[model samples]
Target chain A: MRVLLVDDERELISALAERLEMRGIQTRWVTSGRQAIEAMAQDCFDLAVLDVRMPGMGGLELKHRLAQSCPRMKFIFLTAYGSEQAFDSVATDMGDDFYLVKPVDIQELMAKINLLAGKEDA
Target chain B: MNPAPRSLTMDALQFSGTVTAAFSHDFKNTLAIIKENTGLLVDLLAMAEKGRPLDPQRLATLAERIGRQVQRADRMTAELNRFAHSADLPEAQTDLGAMLEMAVVLSARPANLKRVGLEAVTAPPLWIATFPFGLQQLLYRCIALLLDRAGSGGRIVLEADDGRPPVALRVIARTAEDRIPAGETAPTPTPEMTGLAHALQIRLDWDAAAGGWRLTWRDVET
Candidate 1:
């Protein structure tokens, strides 16, 4: 499945992208929401893995903006905060199924991504 | 009528929350990088077990990157710890330069978000007896305001002057055009700014000619 990853942490996103690619998932990554928007303008993806708190445009806000153009694209939010309150606040606005907290388990993340893309058995 | 002291308490709490949240986010990013690098190593080892040729050079690079991130996390935690303890003593003798340096570090996340570069100029040792936490809060607010006004791709230079009768700290916005446009007066201080200045017992004024804000306070070390 094709995926787009957006995060401000360069090292984290690069390593995660490499791992996802190694697992045979086509993935592209950008370091900021602005960059992700620019990339989306040039290409399309089936799903987006986004970090909730970014510098310029945070993940939630970015997702709202991206939805305007690519209504079919799915989203999975990644956050560093694992607190219930934090999750509940965002989950209430966005869905709870697609959220993962860091340091995320790669296997779990892969499974979630596959499930979100409707390729659960894969 | 003067606002209740509770309002000042709430302001301090808000300031603390803001700084802690910024530091926590930074720490999490650092940890995430380390986790990914280590995971990559594990993946590589698993591949090697399957007869895939493992590049020792790549492994070494990953190890080095992990080590670097660890050190970065250490520094961030240290700064956070120091900031947390800033309130330990309500009032104490404080090193002005050191306090400003810490303020710059704590203010970095917001400054970066605004695409503003922050630089603290070297200043000689200047000791002042004051409310350490209050001073930090005041400095943070001033820096935040300056960052907002700095616009995108701007730079701010922070300087501490020790020789002056009333020691002064200056926040200058580096821009092509002067921070204060011609014939226009300096912007009035917001209520938050006024309250913080009163609490800290410092004079915060706009230095229109210098294109910045100057915070002046008499050294309490008689």
Candidate 2:
């Protein structure tokens, strides 16, 4: 599956993209929401993984923008905040599931990705 | 007359929570980087088992990356530890430069998040005897207000001048976009800023040399 990862932390996102590519998934990464939008305009991707907090535009805001632009794209949020309670208190309407805490286990993340992406396959 | 900080428990808690949350997020990111690097090492080992030779140099590089992240985490914890103990004594001694530097360091994550640069440009070591926690809290609040208004690529400079008795701390901000350029009627101080300054018994005024606030306090024992 083709995926796009957006995170302000360059090293974390770069390493994640490399690992995903190793697993035979087409992956591209960017460090900002502006760049992410630019990239989406350049290519088509099945899913976008975004870190929930960023400098200029946060993940939820970017998600709303991306969803408006690319209706078919899927999203999975990544946050350093581990607890569900803390995530809920983020002062936003991002209450939907499919958000993962940081230091994410690859197997668990991959499982969630498959579950989200698999629905389209069927 | 000094206001009792015990009466400002709610304000103090909020101030502490703000710094703690920022530090927690930073620590998590540091840990996440370490984990990702370790995963790469394991992947390399797995590839070696699959008959592709794992260059020792690649393993060494990953190990080095992990080491740097660990050191970063260590420095963060030490900063947090010092901050946590700041409230231990209502009054404590601290170097003016050191105090300003700590405020700059602590506010860095939040400043970076807003695409603002927070820096300390101090003259030299100037010892001051004062309520350290209250002063620190005041500094953070002022920096935060600036960060909120700062646009992308803006810079805020913190400078300290010790006149021996009354020390002046200047917070000067230069925004990429033209913001209230230094003079012609400065914006009125926010109520929150006024309250924080009053509670800490420090004077907060507009510093129009370029743009920003000037914080002054008297230290008889300096």
Candidate 3:
């Protein structure tokens, strides 16, 4: 499946992308929301994994824009904040079951991706 | 009649508290990143246990990055510790260069977040008998404001000089709001700025023509 990664933290984003690529997934990575929007204009991806607290354009705002542009593209938010309060607020707005915090087990993430991506395959 | 010292003392306390809270929040976030990195390593190990091959090179790099972050986190903690204890404190001999280095590191994260490069012009460690904590607080708040206003790919320069008879540190500004041309008296210190300067026994000058502000400690008796 194709994945798009967005994060201002270069190290984390690069590492995550490398890991995901190793798992046999096609991935494209961008550091900012603007870049992510531009990438979407150029090509479509199955999922967009975003960091929540990027500087200029935050993740939730980016999600809103992406939802409008690419309705079919799924989203998974990766944040350092583990508070339930933060999660609940984002979950209501995102309307998806794929919000995961940082340090998420790769296997669990893969399982969730398989489950979501399988909607088309099934 | 001398202005009541209590009011100045209270203001200093409040300023220190805000600074400490901000610094601690930053430190906490750094720790959180390190925690996440370690957790990722653990996941990689678990994957190896499950008969999946993991890249040794990536693991090594990740380990190195975590170590660097730990040292970064340690330095931030030390700054926070010193700042927290320096409430309405008297003047003491301080290494101006080291203090600026700490502030630069603390400010760099925000600058990097805003895509700004925070740079400091280093001089030899000039001995200044000043309340270093107050100076740090003043500098931190100003840099934070500048970084917030500075757009992506902007640059902020922090320089120290021995020219003011008493040591002086000037923060070179970037944004239109921060620009202060040189050789001019600094604008009146805001009440907040004045209060902080009062606590540190330093004088703050706003130089509009030079496009920056200067803090000097000339009056404090050694």
Candidate 4:
């Protein structure tokens, strides 16, 4: 399955992308919302993993922007500031299954991605 | 007591809470990077154990990257430590340049988000006796205001002017469009900020000619 990862934390995103790729999943990553937009323009992906609090366009905003063109793309948010209130607010708008707290378990993340894309048995 | 002082105290508490949240967010990001790198190393090791060829050079590079991230985390922690202790003392002698440097470091994440550059102008060391935490908050607010005005791809320079007794600390926007006219309504300081400045005898004003904001205070005689 192909995945696009977006985050301002370069090291975290790069490491996550490499780990995902190692697990036999196609992964592409960018450090900003703008880069993610550009990448989406050039290529398509089954899912997009995004950090909720990016500088310019945060994950929620980016997700909204991308929904216009890539309606089929699934989204999962990763955030370091994962308070219950914040999670509930996001869940109210995008549902609970689409969020993951930072320092995420790669296995869990993969399972979620697969589950979201209906590739859990893959 | 008066309600004004009570209100100011509440404002200070709110400011402290805000700064703490920001610092916590930064620390979490740092820890997240380290965690990911370590996790990747584990994955590589598992692969190696499963009879996959391991590139020694790649492992070395990954190790080096993790080391650098640890150092980065260390620096961030040191800054946070310093900031946490700032409130311990009500008033103290502080190096203006050093304080500004700390402010710049703390402001880095927000500035990056806005795509704004922050630079400290080279100047002789100047010391001031004041409420260090309050001063920090004042500087942070000013810098944040400037960054908002700067928009993306703009730069702001921190400068110091040596005066007779009171020295001037300036935040200058590098672009003309970012300049705030003297007559223009400047960003309003928080009530707590105003109280802190008033107590510390610091003057904050817009300098149209300099195209920036100036914070002036009397230097403490050591």
lDDT of 3 by residue, B94-154 (tens): 7787778767865665666577777788887677676766677678766765564445756
Candidate achieving the largest DockQ: 2
User: Which candidate has the top score in lDDT?
Assistant: 1
Best by TM-score: 2
- The Cα RMSD across the true interface for model 3 is 4.0
How close to the true structure is residue B209 of candidate 4, measured as C-alpha lDDT? Answer: 69
lDDT of 2 by residue, B79-140 (tens): 99988988888777778788888898889888887888878887768877767787788788
Taking the candidates in order, what DockQ does each have? Answer: 0.58, 0.76, 0.22, 0.67
TM-score of each: 0.89, 0.91, 0.72, 0.89
Each model's TM-score for chain A is 0.91, 0.92, 0.89, 0.89
Q: CA shift at A73, candidate 3, in angstroms?
A: 3.7
Every model: iRMSD: 1.5, 1.0, 4.0, 1.4
- Candidate 4's C-alpha runs over 4 A off are A82-92, A119-122, B1-6, B176-185, B218-222
Instruction: Give candidate 1's error at residue A33 in angstroms.
Output: 2.1
Clashing pairs in 2: none
Q: After superposition, how far is residue A9 of candidate 4 from its true place, in Å?
A: 2.0
Q: Sort by DockQ, best first.
A: 2, 4, 1, 3
Fnat of every candidate, listed in order: 0.46, 0.64, 0.12, 0.66
lDDT of 1 by residue, B112-174 (tens): 777787888878878787788888888887777666566677767788876457778897776
TM-score of chain B of 2: 0.87
